[model samples]
Target chain A: MSHAIVAPVVLPALVAAFVVMAARFDLVLQRTLSIAGTLTLLGLALHLFLLAGDGVPRPYLLGAWPAPFGIVLVLDRLTATMLVLAQVLAIAVLLYAVGGWDRQGRHFHALFQFQLMGVNGAFLTGDIFNLFVFFEVLLIASYGLFLHGAGAARLVAGFKYVTVNLVASTLFLFAVGTIYAVTGTLNMADLAVKSAQLGPEQSGLLRTGVALLLLVFSVKAALVPLHLWLPGTYGVACAPVAALFAIMTKVGAYAILRVHLLVFGGDDLPTAGLAEPWLVPAAIATLLLGTLGLLAARTVQRLAAFSVIASMGTLLLALAMPGPAATAATLYYLLHSTVAAAALFLLADLLAERRGAVRDGIVAAPGFPQLDLLAGGFLLGAVATTGLPPLSGFLGKVWILEVVRAHPAWPWLWTALLVTSLLGLLAFARAGSLLFWKPAALPAPVDPQPQARPVLPLVATGGLLALPVLLALFAGPIGRALEASAAQLHDRRGYVEAVLGPGRSAAMVER
Target chain B: MELLFASGVGVLTAVGVYLCLRARTFPVVLGLSFLSYAVNLFLFASGRLVVARPPIVGPAAPGYTDPLPQALVLTAIVISFGMTALVVVLALRGFLEAGTDHVDGREPDREGRS
Candidate 1:
């Protein structure tokens, strides 16, 4: 059980290495290995999730180097929950890609496995520096995956994405350097303790460090003013890569919860409530921008991309609020939004594939095979994205609305969220109407090309679409678990003790 | 010395940001490299400005500079080096494919109309 903590990080790593070294020329072997690896990870994530049901933070020391010295990977309710979420999405995405998308590029399976390793490591590692390393690992893999098929549009977007991330990475280094210099330890639990004992003089530096860190995460999360790279990147990326990217944004959200909320959350600290003044307002702006962009989007892919930004806004808005109720809402919404966005992107790709010349431009194009079925799928995806009733999106938004009552500016928040949600619905409705409602034959009709049945892609998409419904059905149990996870998240002392052992954290050994 | 070092880092960072905001890809890549150098230097300085001190705990060692920041600096250098290589190749590819060095894949419109 203790060793299972490392499996989520190590398993994909071993598979990724073996796949590259052994199955370099064999796509069949690569697919089989990747599928088997993801399934195993899903099983491991479930087991760990159950293991963490007791709400104890379980730390696995790397090479027994001990916490605050070497890296430690902690498995707790929040970590376990994120693990399960990532693995589930990985399974669906891997299934979606193996159909034919993996054929577009070399090392897709290998890079994907490494991406999993990086994501799992980021979630599991208890040290901030280790988190940065894992972030690079995932990002490097994503860079390859983004440029996988290599086209003019993709190359242009790739340049921007790579440049933006590189800049953010430098900022990350500055933030880490500042933080380590001030705290004398890179271990998160140690920082939590050290930060509490900090003199007021150091608060400014600590705030500067973490604030820079927040800027980096905001780039990843696609928060406004920092979100320019996302639409073009995701919009031009092929569907499977774009679907996989849904989890990447959530990784940023997760970082904020772990580092910003837990490490910097104490009322005793001068930096307490640091994200308060701007986070919600920024989130509101992000929502308005995303929804407006969605309405303005000329292509189905762009529409889905903008919706991702909007859902992130909703998730971050809930996250910025203090209290377990809000955090629980944030977590629930995180699950809903990631899956929903993936489903929407997948459906958009299907539309692109079917409409040969039009290529999912929201113009009226005579659609192709299974048009009605794809339209139905689009309806559900848009419903979940726009927070319509009977799906998890509506439930998630309801939970968020319920939790924000105590917020000092709840009235403004309510107005903005509701108004933007309505705008989001209108945007999707317009997109759905333009794409699905009007079907006019092209000036020169596309010749019917013989194509293989899209059974796998359709099944994979349907499988993704099923999750939002299932989440709503299982809302009772899931809500209870999320509430517990949220409570555990706010209990920073528990985490400190779990990583560093009892009373060890408070003892400042000045080196 | 601290003033000189700090000024160097700040100047590099300022130039880097300015170039990063430019319209073309080459300058952006160069800017990123400059920013990376600035960060690497800043990170190294985080251990404090000490010269010729070994990062060892043994009695033979007179003193030790903080070794962790050096390790971190090495990691940053490697990542930035690899990333810079990637962006250079990507920019070259984008130029060849799109026939434009402009970051947006096309020439800027004089009147800002599509």
Candidate 2:
């Protein structure tokens, strides 16, 4: 691991800290600084990605302390992948901000950059405590962005979003505290090492700690029972902010995948007893509820919000499935859902803006039929979500079924997933019908800025849709990578070895 | 000592959850604030409550409190404060615009109004 590689990860956060101090007249300078910071971070991520391709690992320790002592930053294939995806989305969203860039929203742009910094830091950080800090940074930025514009609706929804997250953050703290109390270390790698020595009772306590951590992440991911804040709040936010948040939910999913699957043991194979046995059923329920919400939704934005919830369910389902195949499916689904949800949300925002209001129903946009231009795109995305053939989503589902087919008890889980995927298709079909097939009376005084629409949103939508298509086309290599990562995830020894090196602690390697 | 603190947190959590389930936005926000306090304390206590010995480094600190949890709790405190302010502002805005603060809002009186 290269020692100097941590500078890029730290620079954006430094810029963000500096940005908070600038005077009003330095607004232009602040935006410039923020943009430059993201660009620099993007460059570093790309550079490290290239390095990973060459089979080099990069680890940077903060404050000159060694790993398991001071904070550490890790740069590997997974971190590189998430970094690239996040930076691309961050840059696209920033460009999209060019449309309504004004002094009133300058703070928003600054905070957006800060949010990106936090996201990148979280992905790169090698320590658990650092992850909490980064999460706080991102959440604070999100609160500002959620309330950036508009009037009462945005504020009301924003309040709910903020309140729920505040509670989640607190729970997150408790989880971290509990873990530290048990393991006597805050470094994730160190915790994994120390935790191995614990007895069954101690392990159970750690499981509770992990469950508490999941509680916060579930709220962030908008799992079924906890998703009430999403629809109304996300439905009314302006287009760019909504698009930005479309990707933010994935952060929670990412946490579940990273912390539970990586930092903690027992989530791996051969330890089905690791987490709760209820996760699968809960995931299936979430999927059904989300799809149902979509079917019942009236407006485009609300439908998209519900779709986000359903996508979360699908990701969870992917996680709950058996073996390497299931892990592979989870990875593919994560990429697919993030892209599709983002594109659909951005498109919904455009449609809403075209209409005077989101309440105007589907008829507001007279060019509803013209959306057929995106029919092929939506169909491809829908097929992936529905687990239909030739799409990555299908490949994922097939893999999961292959792994779990022999287990008689798991049949019901499979059935639930199949049913929900079908329901998802039905929901999308309804959206298609409303947006394309059915028509209603146009509202008075249509938008004047129809033809010369903003170029950034178009680019944003195009970029989001393009990713999954590329993923499908190159599914072979991507699937292989995911399977490999999942195998690494399942076998605790490899992760422990990588983080702690061999022969460091014989008792730690007792597993 | 730890048990008492944990129990207090539990009570705070229960109260917060009950308040959150209420119809009006103000009580919900208050409930959330209380819940956050409970959560913050819970997180702090999760490290198992040692006094006058925070996890920061010093020469005589053989049994220093875990620094990582404290750092995490600090961030949580700051973020929760921001969240509370934002939620309060948002609730005020909604109250002004919709003429009510209940989440459901009488189902918008859709029946006879139109």
Candidate 3:
């Protein structure tokens, strides 16, 4: 069972190394190895999910060292859920990349595998420093992936992305250093215990450190005033890579949720409720920025990027509120937004491929072949992104609204969400009509060249588009599971006890 | 001694932030490198700057330095080194491809459209 917890990280690392060493030049072998590795990871994620569903937080201590000393990997319901989401998206993006996208750049397959390894490690690791290492692993891989096709625009965007993140990484290290200086521990559970026992002066320093940490995560989450790098970066990235990046922001959200709720959540601690004051207003501003960006975007890819930002805003708004209901709503909305954003990116790529010179620009160009299929995909994606009815987007938003209705900030939250949804609807409607409804007046080409759409790419994208549909269908069981996970998250005592043993956390509290 | 280290870190970070806000690629990369050095020092100092003490545990030793921060700083130094190298390469690539070193990839518009 412990091995299962490690498998997701280990398998990808091994496969990535093998691909670099043995299958460097063999595209076929690399593809086979990559796919097989991701499939195995998906299987392991599902297995871990089942094991975690029993409500036990399983902690795997490395080298048999006890808590606070060893590197640990915890497989709780939240981690398992994240692992499955990441693997599912990885497999989908890998399938799409296999349709000649991987050949566009060197080391694409290896970098993709390393990226998965980083993400999985981030989700599983129980120590904060390990989280930083995994974050770098994933970030470095993302940098390589972002520049895969290597255009001038991509190069420039990649430069900005690297610079911004380097600064953020520095801040992360500084924050970690401060926390360690004050508390002398980096393990999450130990920090939980130590933080609660801090004296007044120590509490002030710890609060500063915790605040810095939250700022670092906010940058990763692309909260407004820090989101300038996202649109440009995602806009210039290739379609499949952009699709994979949908989950990257969610990784930041997960860090905030996990660290904030677990380490700084004690009622008597000065750091308790630290994030709430800042997160809500910034999240609302982010929503506004996203909506305005969507309205002004001239291309499908940029519009899709803005929608991603908007969805992140929605997720963070729920997260700012402290309750199991809000956490559950955030998780459900997170799942829906990730899938919808990825599908939109892929669909934009498909449209770009078909339109040739127009390349997904929001202009009425002559309709290309496979019009029906492309139109249907775009419509479904548009509906999902705009949070229209009969999709998980709608369900997730309704759930969040319902959960936030009783909060003191309910009026502002409700207005921002509803107004933004309306604005998003208008933007998508305009984009859809311009791209699909308006018929161009150009005559048919005399050459009559027949372009064949690859069956595999379509299948890959179709599979992603089907997710929101499936989410809505199984919302009952999934909602229940998320509620249970959120309850477990809120029950910080259980987590501390699980990792530190039954009496240890209680003993610390007594002292 | 601690005051000197703190001021050094502060100066490095301030200069780094200033350079990072510049509109060119090379300066920005250099700034990031400087900021990383400052952070590394900060991490090292987190162990409380013990002097004349061994890092290893010894039965006869009076007191030893906290070895964990050393380990962390070593890992952090290696990671930051790699990061700096990667950024330098990326900046060079951007310069080569875009025919300019401006971080925004183009000359600023007369109307300030960026």
Candidate 4:
């Protein structure tokens, strides 16, 4: 299974090519191949997770090339955890899409397969420049998917999305060039060693590079000042695309943790604690904006979009501090928020169809079919999203609160956390009563058309909504796994030696 | 030489940012291209400038430029090229669909234009 490290990246890439080249003529064939490839990827991801469970960082050198001289894909607990989470989200989103979304857009399945290939590659790559390549891979596929079943609104929004990401990519190259100039290598582990040992003159340039890198990642994470792109982009996307996009923001958070924490994190490094000053205040602002925007949102889709920003706010807040407790909480909250946000988006789409003219707007509509089932799903998703009790959101919030109690700005953090949770609860409750309760109390309007809602998409939404409950039930084991992942993440020396080998022989690769 | 190269990058970036802030998609697309050009130049020079040296590793070579930046620059150029093509097509689509070239897809008022 030594090759399992590469399977998550390689398998989907090959599958994407075959889907385009062989199955291009038939939709049925494309769906079958795409779904089968995803399920197999799930199995490979799980096997790799078990492999990484021993707390060892396994670096797979491509083409038998030595470290620092060739590209390496490192499989560790952190990468494996992300892979499993991504695949699970992909399956649910795919199921929901096939219920009819893929039919609306040409080449959805092919683009989807390529998207998975890129996400998996991004998670596995050990070289910084390779990560840029994977980011472009995923972003390009996403641009196509973002405009799937294109409309005027979507095309306009897609323009801005593409432009924003293009700018971010340019900044990414600028940062990488600066770092390469100083460190002379783009291998992350080697950079960690070289950057830490740099003299003061080089330290200034390195910090500037690190700061620019932070900007690019934050744009992806949707942190404040750079988060203007999220609401517009996610709100207008097709539901399943938005659902899959739940992990996209998490990719940004993952890069921050991987690069900022492990590569240039320690006291000896020039860039140590660089993200700390910016993360806390900006995260809180992001959370505040999300809460206020929730009440102001006209469409439930926009509401869900803002909720993503808020959830990232909480995740990034935990990310501000790097300890076993905080990092573990960050990881768990990351999982819960992604599943919960996806559930909200799917539920919004379902409601959109039933409401007809209102089409996902918060205004009340007459009773629609399966109101009770849909209502229940909304309530569960809301509970999870608003951090209410008896679900994973509340659990994650409690963990975060405990860990952040030691921060210098604990009072501001607590007030922001508590106030936002209350307001979010109120927003959801008001939206629910208007959409579900008021409609139920009123008579069912005489309808021009009342189509029987498909059962498959409902089942998919219900399955995603149920994950929060499952996460709560299995909190102990999942919590332990994340704790171990956090420990592995913080132990920089272990990661460095794992990638570069003992005696640090990467210098020999130099000309 | 350093001052010239640094100022060149700075000026390209300044122009890029200025055009990017314009209210039309055409300017934004052009700005993105300019920004990419600046970045490509910056990446090419990251290994430091050298003259009359081969990049290969051989005993006869008196000196060598860093070959890695060349590789990096090549990759950056290809990606940026593809990205520019995609964005231009997208901007064209937006203009066709919305029937306006404004970045926000709405025509500006006469008063605002003035």
**Each candidate's TM vs. the true structure?**
0.96, 0.86, 0.98, 0.98
Residue pairs that clash (backbone atoms under 3 angstroms), model 2: A174-B43
A351 in model 3: Cα distance from truth in Å?
0.5
True interface contacts reproduced, per candidate: 0.92, 0.71, 0.94, 0.92
Query: Where is model 4 chain B poorest over a 10-residue stretch in terms of lDDT?
Result: B105-114
Over the stretch A78-141, how does candidate 2's per-residue lDDT look in tens digits? 6777777788777767666655543445576667777887787777787777888888778777
DockQ of 4: 0.92
- Model 2, residue A192: distance off in Å is 1.2
lDDT of 3 at A83: 96
Q: lDDT value for candidate 3?
A: 0.91
The order by descending DockQ is 3, 4, 1, 2
lDDT of 3 by residue, A340-380 (tens): 99999988998888887889999988868787788899888
Q: C-alpha displacement of A440 in model 2, angstroms?
A: 12
Per-prediction TM-score, chain B alone? 0.94, 0.84, 0.92, 0.93
Model 4 clashes, total count: 0
Segments of candidate 3 deviating more than 4 angstroms:
A440-448, A507-511, B109-114
Q: Per-prediction DockQ, in order?
A: 0.90, 0.52, 0.92, 0.92
lDDT of 3 at B86: 94
- Estimate the TM-score for candidate 1: 0.96
Better of 1 and 4 by lDDT: 4
Candidate of highest lDDT: 4
